[model samples]
Target chain A: MLSVNRINTYRIPFTFEYYRPRTLREALEILRSVEGAKVVAGGTDLVVDMKFRRVEPKALVDVSKLEELRYVRLVEDYVEIGSAVTLQELVESEVVRARLPLLWEAVNSMASWQVRNIATIGGNICNASPAADTAPPLLAYGAKLLLTSLDGVREVGIGEFFVGPKRSIIRPDEVLQAIRVPVHPAGYGWSFRKVSRTSFDIAKISVAVLLKVDGGRIRDPRIALGAVAPTPVRARSTERAIESLSLEEALEVGPRFVEGDIAPIDDVRSTAWYRREVAKVLLRDSLRTAYERSLNPGWVHEG
Target chain B: MRVRLRVNGSWVEVDVEPHETLLNVLRDRLRIRSVKYGCGIGECGSCTVLLNGRPVTSCLVLAAGLDGTSIETADYLAKTELGTRIVNALLLEGAIQCGYCIPGFLVTIYAALKSGMIRRGDSTEIARAISGNICRCTGYINIVKAVRRVVAELVAIGAD
Candidate 1:
């Protein structure tokens, strides 16, 4: 039984030291040395959870103060987005807006502008929610997660990062350092669609598509869906179905392929049946829109 | 834990628990009740305050984490000339009903006006700027009227 004396309505029971390290090495060392410590980047997610009694960490290592981790750099063949970079920063960045427009689109459709100002890209991915807005677009872009620990740093494919809903392959002592996305060729066109109960609410079903097309024949296609399964998933079957088809034919077959790819569950916001149906509809619409834009980039400005 | 911050243009030193929120520190310790605790969560903008000149929900912000940051609450605006004009307009327009949400609305609009995001005499821009704050009283008609009146006054002063 939970102890009544141990619980406080206004504060947490346990008191631990709070450390705001100036450097990444100092922060990582504190995280490794302190037991049950949580790394706080932006604190948009962790602080809310802590206030609501959802998560209680023994110590909080504030990583937002580390200026070195807050950067967006374009390397040789990939764009490296530091984990501490805020969603608003990512959305407004000329590099991200010009190079990765799909990510910008996804970031724009996320929570309100005020929330996005403080919510970090790393927090969204680290939270590991299936409905995370940034995941589907990043996965579709073939991004890789950079994880660092006291031992060493390693990269993992974004698709394989999530083990389940609200769970990831990241170790307790490891932190997400950065996300590296391979630069796409100039001809790639992308689109992101989200179906939510309200414009600002969480998504019921979302879809992202990145395709390289020449005269309506698909050269390469990538599709990812969110809020339909326990984790964001690539609809490879849907990609295969529309690989050799024209834009119009692909739209017709896209819904059928998506219907078979996702397994949704009934939740408070929506039922499994409604989610599946919307997933199919969004997948079809997103593919059609992406294909049309790829054929004629000028269509984006037309109404 | 002890956290010292600049509040309402004044440096305040307060000792708060590790789990204390900025809202708690502002109201309980500093005795600035203007920032109300309606929801005790980020959903309600009642606890909104300006952290480094950007509007953020204070209930979600940790007081310990806000060290070395500047915070501005609705009360700080009462000292400004533009703020005085807007308050008078709000009172004249009967925009205050229960007065629970007035502080949040005032702080948000003050920041928006000071930022020059909404030009003087632009009602639509003012409305869009304050869209994030929800007010349950006066049906928002009088609130819009109050903002427009203040904006018109500011524009007239600029002409002077």
Candidate 2:
């Protein structure tokens, strides 16, 4: 049954010029020429936002058809995923499930299969939502983004990519081309946790943790929290508190240090207080599970 | 803009607006009614269709971006024998209440069965495959049963 709201209709409220570029160079050229042009990969977020009058770009350059940005490959010491690689492709890749399990987990925790079929990793990051499921995992994994423009290409660390909610350092003329995620060494445990209203709903609080445990003591743990601040942020204080401590010891003290890392605000989905409280719980759970996975790399944990 | 794509095995060229979704082009321009519009957003599965042999929400897809792509909707799919069998199985299992979401589920099941991604009678796999679709009448139990029924038939006939 369709719930038709008078205000929110299927019709896109505004008209915009559209371009479907076949190649990366052509797409970049269109971006450079068209003033106030926005790049649409999946349109899972941008289309809905347009219907709601959240963003009204003068034109849209559709890069969904560009073959240059639709791949997932291992190059050198990193796994490079093209920005246009769909979420469904990420979920079906055995390499992603094996090498980057947290990334797989984050993709699984995202929207439903229908949405995943169209949504791309590049679109998720470029959309720059604070609760973008892929951001926390990329942040913890120390991934770098490849941004391309007519002038040249530049790489930006994932941690510094997002400037604010719905904003990133991406220039109007540049497009996110690919994401380079460093391959983890042995004995590294990774876990991603997302708290949402339903399996398909957006996350209220999501956390991803990567830890290396050696001989029962944690080493250089990294924590990333989402939907708790203006942008997905790494919890350095929490990581420092848990570093060099046993799993049990970290669980006791690490959560307390998270308060200094996140600045949550009340929204329609949840309250700031609730987000703050759950952030700690999720951090503890992620840390414990990550430690367990670190001990046994063969362990399989579903998102 | 003039966009050209293959729809249900036929080449289609249409003049469409930049913001026009594939759902509108299919239903309004081509008269392909199997792809229903629901929740206009990506949340509802009523508008599910096969894009390049993969299941996708047609409502979220812009028609202008689908140039040179292949799309399949249930309306054209029902011409095939397997599609007809699946439709019959749904009625046998009493899974067609209200009938709005049936087209999406059928198209998704068709794609999943063709892809060979799920084992026969694996309800968990089947449920996960169709998790994107919403049946507001709460007819999921029977819908799953209907899919299982079709799978059993396909297995009996030794169809891949």
Candidate 3:
């Protein structure tokens, strides 16, 4: 049995250099110079992993104080979210709650209120966990990640950003500055579904769907699933299979198409069979909700 | 690293290692024992504290990152009128069984009531607000009752 004192024993059991850069330039310089420097925005995930010895960087660049990386703007065709914006800020934003209900749902279900207060979207994306709750929604929305460094800035499509589980294409010196999410067109319906061990737990399987309906036929359907693959992936085959179909007809063929898109595996959270079954149900449920919501946008706001 | 922060309304500076968590600094250096350490990971909310007026698990917060922030723990809240009201309600509801989780729950309840996200007698809101906190002893029934009672009292008195 672990002693009581051991509960807080790892609370700084090791030592490493720390840097708090006031400006983005300074942070980038430190990252560029240091061999094993990690940027800590919220430190919610990084700190815990460090305590568990899962990661041990030579230095930590604290960027939570960089005021430049904090804003939420609705531009002409996109919603630009500063990567440092906490999940709590996302939940509190009326624009997010109204204009991007799918993203809002995904963020709201990601973590508890307390954790949400400190966890940032940048950290969530940079962690690149297959079970990341925000990934599917962002993938469905076709978001883009803004990566900045001493060199300059570049934008990577969200789909291309995540390479695999616990890994991404993020350069060692680059910092994710903001997430640019395309605003959904009017008359589009979207839904997000997550199956977790508990209400506040990480997801075993999650799905996000966005589609438009005209004349009782689906159009431009998009589907994304998380935790069932190495990276959150768009269900292209599933979307193609259900295009131009009525809600009833789509539901009939959706589950089979989903099986082709996702590759589930046994894990501590759930069995591969359970994930496949739940993924099918979630796909159907999200499709039904999206279909119903397409008929009435105001219905999306309803409880 | 030399870090400075306002803890419980007092500005203090301490040298903390890069790996040190805010929980370690609070309990070890500042001697704030009310912030209990249940699970070092963020799963358990035993080390919850208010960072810049928002409740967060201090165990997950790096002390080095809190260089210029403000933190409030349960011990700090116990002095306020709202904190006293919550404590009385907890007592009335018999929420504290083993008392291991009381400090964390009290801090969480205080933040919830103060944030205005929850209203009086809304058990659903109360539960949602504190869902991150794990209370093994009481099964959360009495704790929910206690929070509701405090909310009702605050509402009746017109305390915003």
Candidate 4:
């Protein structure tokens, strides 16, 4: 028999309420009425944190049953992903793999298959961990977050949605409804690299690079880094430095520029010095790989 | 909270704490002791069960969330002909060992087999499908052998 820990009884702070809302309107009403209500999608991250007493909300509004927030569609120039969609769904989605391969790559490299089955993209973004796997790719893809509350709907850039570690601009009453990823035209190349102790370890440092090249000169470039800052950040300095550089010159200068932009901390996963060094390495490698794949489209593999 | 679920083709209703894990509810409330609790977390696959035809870690699944869902435990394996063949092969091949992890292994393999995830006559596919499950005693040699035997039987019976 497994050793059962003695159950401890604490005085009820108050009888917290649990509400299961099946529709978007019902969910919004519950979130608007409850003072400290939380929206539970897959409960992969929330329930674990609650069990450890890290988070205690007055009410939990289960939104896993909301079918409206569980789809992936390509509309106009963007691929809109519903917030309640599971990581597993994203990883296995044929449309996601076809249109947004980098997003598929990042999601596949996250927690094991079982966790992916229950972890939702919205929960991942809402949890707002600095090491979130989906953020860098989404940011690189120029994704827009769609948030909804009883008041109305609002959209925010993925980069601006995250304010700090374990924090976002989302209000207590607002729930993330969808992620809109702008579709890059053909010939745009992308790469995502996550360095960790093991394949399953939370990213020590992750880098995403997107490049579009025309006639061997950079047409457009975007770079994002995670786990090396308070929030996943676009490396504007590094991106600007390589904006006009040739593919060869960009390869040489990208790492040096990236090394100067990040502010990493020494944590249990890695030291500041190591993270910075790996950040440079990953940035250079991902840039080179993305550039090569962009110029040679046939080399890119579909996930 | 009182939750009702279809377990192994039978309706089971039990009252459980809102926070109680599905693993706890299965073993404690339903007396489905076959689902062992190893590592209480999802890391160890000893508490695996089929939820709506997919193998999921029952430890991380809350009982409240499983209301009205179809759950399959190891005890149900004997009801199907293919399941009985696999179970018989396991016994004949001496894959039992400590037996604590057998139930989860059985359920995981059953789901994999029924889903056509592990095609007949493919031992590598069978091994990869059940790689999530950890068996401390068997060292997996006999377990793989038993699975291979079942694969062969499945091929001969045209049950692919």
Candidate 5:
């Protein structure tokens, strides 16, 4: 039996220098100077990797102390969220809940309240898990990410952020600064549905839909699915197909197009066959709900 | 690295390795028994603590970064009026099985109820609020019943 005291020293068997930068500029400088350095925020994901020796770093740049990157504010037509803002803070923010239901619902369906308190949205995005619950919603919302480096800031749409499973285009010297979710026009309806082994577990399959119903026809639909491909992807082919059909016809024929756009594989959480079938059902249901909310403008006030 | 933390209203400073977790610092150095190591990952809430008044898994938090933060554990909370009421309710409802998960449950419950997320007679919300902790022995029914009972009394007396 292991002594209770062993849990402390058993963590991270390797030694590494830790840097907690006080300012964003200092953080960037450390990232630029330190070789084999990794940025940690919340430390919920990176620390776990270190514990299992999945990743080993020579220096860890702590971005949590950079206060400039911890905020959620409404500026003009979008809600800008700092990368260091915890998932719990997003759940508690009025701007996120009121204006970004697609993003809001996904955050709520994630790990327990305890993990959410320490997990950052930026970490979720940069980790680039295929089953990232926040990705589908952010993709559906057409959100934008601001990556900061000493060179300056560059904007990348969320859809273009991920390159592969657990991979992204984030440069070594840059940090994800803020996420901008557009305060969509009032006529849109949003739905985010995730299915996991348990409510707190990683997503087996998830879908987010942002639909507009105008005069009984679906227009410019944005559908995103997670845990179906190497990366969370927007179903553009499905959207183009749905937009050309009436709401009733699309509800009947739309889900099939999702199969063409995604290639789910069998994994520990679920089988590819099961994911394909269940994803169709979720897409249909989400479309129905989103259609209803689009017609009933009163649903906009539901916070 | 040296980290300074305020635990249960008392400030203490300790030397921590860069990889040392807050869970290690509290349990080994501070001898705070409220936290336990059920799982090194955040899946199990047995290592839960209140960081700046919000419930978080201490095992996932690096101690070196928490230089001047405040922490609250079940060790300090078990003495308060609300904590006493929660303990009595758990006992009254026969929620203890092995009693190993009780401290983690108590800490999660205290933070949720104190924050007003769990309301009177709302069993579903109560279960969701305390879902962070996993109890391998006692099923959650009696535990949910205990929280419901605590909320009812707190409401009746107009206390939170």
Candidate 6:
């Protein structure tokens, strides 16, 4: 149900100690020391979970205040984005807009501007929601995560990050430090589309695609979908089906293979049957747009 | 925990619980009525407020996490020059109905007008700027008109 129908309680029913550390190191130490501590940056997801008693941690280690964890830069070969960087910041950044248009599209299509002001990429990924809009783009981009703990730092690809609903591979003591997406060549094209009940509603189905057309042949195509499976996933079979075909042929046959990659189920927003049907349309349309954008780089995204 | 906020151009210190949201802190503790609590979740922009010149839902913001931050609510903004212009624009266009969502809308509009979020009077651009605020009344036609007027006025004065 939409939140406008019902009013939530005035305050969080359960209480927890809140720790806002000054530095990334201090935040990690607090996360390691506190029992059942959770990392909170924007609180868009965690606060709601805590309010509904869906998740109750003993303490909260806030990383939003850490200056070191708020950055968006293009390193030698990858886009280095701090985990604590807010979605609005990412949306407004010129570096991200030009370098990762699909990510910008995904973030721009997310929750209202009010929510985007404080929502962080790390929280969106960590929440691990099946309908997370950010997940599909990250998965298509083959993004990587840097999870840090007292022991050391470990990197995990975004495709293997989420295990199930509201669950991830992140350890209790580890904090997601940064997200890195390898910079693709200049000729790569991308597309992102999300169909929600309303303009501001959560996605019922979403699709993201990235590929390059070399001499009429689609190469290195990556396709990802959301709200269709237990986790936002890469459509491996669909990618393989369109590997050597022309964009016109891929548009006709790629969408058919998408059914084999996703396992949809009935939910409040949509049903498995409906999702299975809409998935084909979403893929076909995105493949067409991706093909168009691949041919025209200047018009990757229109204002 | 205790924190200080520069709210509506005034600095005040308030003691708040660790789990207390900014919505509760502003309404229950500080007696700021402009910030409404329509939804405890982030979906409803009824709890919208300007934190550091950016619009954010107060319900999802932890009061304990914000210290020495600047907050601007509709209550204080209604008295400012920009706020007065926005209210007048809405009034001239007859944009208010039951008015439950106006406060949040006003804050969002004021923030958008003050920033470069809406550079032109385009309906789609203005609609995206105010998408956070939900008005049950008036189909947002007059609201968009009001913003368009403000955008034109700002453009004429070279203020934006």
| lDDT, candidate 6, at B56 | 93
Cα RMSD to the true fold for all candidates: 3.8, 2.2, 1.8, 3.7, 2.4, 2.1
lDDT of all predictions, in order shown?
A: 0.81, 0.89, 0.88, 0.81, 0.88, 0.89
Alpha-carbon interface RMSD for all candidates, in angstroms: 2.7, 0.9, 1.5, 5.2, 1.7, 0.9
Instruction: After superposing candidate 3 on the true structure, give the runs of residues whose Cα lies further than 4 Å from its correct spot.
Output: A1-9, A300-303
For residues A1-303, what per-residue lDDT tens digits would candidate 3 score against the true structure? 867555343475578999999899999999999999998898778877777678888898988778878888899888999889999999888778877889998888878888999899889999999988899999999999999999999999999988888899999999999999988778999899998988889999999999999999999999999999999999999999999999999999999999999888898999999999999999999999999989996664522
Superior candidate under lDDT, 4 versus 5: 5
* Candidate 6 lDDT: 0.89
Give candidate 2 misplaced runs (Cα > 4 Å): A1-4, A300-303
* Residues A1-303, model 4: lDDT tens digits: 555654221111223567767689998898888898888877767666665567777788878768999999999889999998988789778888878888887887887555666779999999998899899999888899999988888999998999988999999888899999987658988899999875656899999888898888886798999999989889999999999788789878888888777889999999999999999889888988888879876554444
Give the 10-residue window scoring lowest on summed lDDT in candidate 6 chain A: A1-10
Q: Cα lDDT for residue A139, model 6?
A: 91
Cα lDDT for residue B136, candidate 2: 87
Give the CAPRI class of candidate 2.
Answer: medium
**Model 1, global lDDT:** 0.81
* DockQ of candidate 1 relative to the true structure: 0.42
**Quick one: ranking by DockQ, best first?**
6, 2, 3, 5, 1, 4
Which residue window of length 10 is worst by lDDT in model 2 chain A? A1-10
True contacts kept of each: 0.27, 0.75, 0.73, 0.05, 0.72, 0.88
Give candidate 1 regions above 4 Å deviation: A1-15, A296-303, B85-95, B116-131, B138-160
Q: Which ten contiguous residues of candidate 5 chain A have the minimum total lDDT?
A: A2-11
| Candidate 4 global CA lDDT score | 0.81
Docking class of 6: high
State the displacement of the C-alpha of residue A27, model 1, in Å, after optimal TM-score superposition: 1.3
**Tens digits of lDDT, candidate 6, B43-116:** 76888999999999999999998899999999889889888988999999999998888999999999888787
